[model samples]
Target: MPAIVHFEVRIDPERRDEAAKYLAETLAATRAWPGNQGIEALVDDADPCHILVVETWATTQDHDDYAAWRTTPEGKSSLGEILAAPPSKQVYSETLPLGL
Candidate 1:
């Protein structure tokens, strides 16, 4: 089954717009990455400095591979110095719906 990954990042208030633009420019590559089903970038309404990236991957290993690539120099170069704190990530699986 596909996995859902939540990535949360806190950007400096002054750099929030830059951060959003960066995501917009870079996420197409992410969406094109292997095993990536899709991704959605969201910002907190009450806290614009907070950003959330929801990603769907074909499997956990695929997400792990993507993460490994992100640590490379090329990947690091693509992501400018926009984060106020290290990004946080969590992986989740869908729960079966309860029958009424």
Candidate 2:
């Protein structure tokens, strides 16, 4: 079954534009990574600096592997430069689409 992962982060208000560019450049690797189905980044309406990243993967294991890699020195991303607070994440599995 496919898995859905939500990654939410609060960006520095002064670096909103930079965050856009940074996420684009960084997430490109994720998009190309094995087992990645798709990914999207969205900004909050009430808070311009708040961003949510939605990612789809082939399975929970696939997402876990990708996430584990991000913690490594080689896979580390530069999110610290733009973030105002630590990021939060949620995982969902066993999806059942209802043709919405």
Candidate 3:
């Protein structure tokens, strides 16, 4: 089954643009990942400082691989500064019936 991952990020209001820039660059890389299906980022219209990143993958294993890769020295070095705080993440498996 496909996997859906969501991450909620709370950033400093002053750094909202910086955070968006960082995500734009990072998500570009994710979009090219082997198992990545889709990626989206949304900013809360009412609360500009809050951001949500949603990702879809071919399978759970794909997300696991991505997580491992993210811990690598190269990845950490690139992603270290953008985050204002640790992201809250969740995983979901999609279920759908045919012929909606």
Candidate 4:
């Protein structure tokens, strides 16, 4: 079954725009990664400095591999410096489905 991952990124208010731009630039490569189902970046309306990155993957292992890759030199280089704090990540599995 697929899994959902959420990354809560907090940036300095002054650098929010730059962070958003970096996210946009990096998303293409992320989406192209194997096992990635989808990815999205959303900025909080009440708190512009907070950006939420939602990602769906084929499995937990897939997400873990991608995360490990992101820490490598190549991945680190692609990510520009625009963060106030380290991103917080959480993983979830769909236990119950509500018909919409």
Candidate 5:
């Protein structure tokens, strides 16, 4: 089953456009292992400083691999300026009770 990965980042309001542009380019250029599906980014309407990135992958392994890459010095160097603070994140597996 695919996994849903949620990413939340808080960026300086004044830097909103810059943050979005950075994310857009980064994700576009990112390459992942097999089983990677797609990614979507959302900006909070009520809070311009808050941004969310939702990603779907064919399995947890793909997400793990991508995450490991993000922690590397090269990765940090690329994304360092776009962040106002550390990002908040979570992962989930979809479930339907009663086979629904």
Candidate 6:
């Protein structure tokens, strides 16, 4: 089953809108990456500088591979430039809820 990745980041207050625009441009490569199902970025309603990225991949391993590549210079994303600090990430498995 596919895994869901929640990536949270806070952009530099100075970059603001520019950071959002930059992310839109940069995420194209991620959307096209192998095993990527889809990607969506959501800005916090209370804090425009904060962003939450929801991503779906064929499997946890797929996301892991992509994450490892992101650490390398070749596949590194320019996000660090606009980020105020390091991002947070967590992977989750889909689950069914029992009826009450």
Residue ranges of candidate 6 with Cα displaced over 4 Å: 94-97
Alpha carbon deviation, residue 84, candidate 1 (Å) = 1.2
How many clashes does each candidate structure show, in the order listed?
0, 0, 0, 0, 0, 0
lDDT of 3 by residue, 1-100 (tens): 8999997888766666687677777788788888999999888889877888899999999988987887887655343365667789899986767887
What is every candidate's alpha-carbon RMSD to the true fold? 1.8, 2.2, 2.5, 2.3, 2.1, 1.5
Lowest-lDDT window of 10 residues in candidate 4?
A: 74-83
| Cα lDDT tens digits for candidate 4, 15-96 | 7668757887888778988999999988899988888999999998888898898888876633447778878999986667
9-99 per-residue lDDT for model 6 (tens digits): 9999998868867788778877988999999999899999999999999999999898898888888788788999999999997778888
The top-ranked prediction according to lDDT is 2
In candidate 1, position 48 carries an lDDT of 87
Task: Estimate TM-scores for all models.
Answer: 0.86, 0.91, 0.84, 0.85, 0.82, 0.90
Winner of 4 and 6 under lDDT:
6
lDDT of 1 by residue, 1-100 (tens): 8989998989877777688678877787788889999999888999888889999999988888988888887665344478888889999867687997
The runs of at least 3 residues in candidate 5 whose Cα sits more than 4 Å from the true structure, single-residue gaps closed, are: 30-33, 94-100
Model 1 earns a TM-score of 0.86
Q: Is candidate 3 or candidate 6 better by lDDT?
A: 6
Model 4, runs deviating above 4 Å:
77-80, 94-100
lDDT of 6: 0.88
What would the per-residue lDDT of candidate 2 be over residues 1-100, giving only the tens digit for each residue?
7999999999998998899789998899899889999999998999989999999999999999999999999999997889999999999997578999
lDDT of each: 0.83, 0.92, 0.80, 0.83, 0.76, 0.88
**Error in Å for residue 94 of model 5:** 4.7
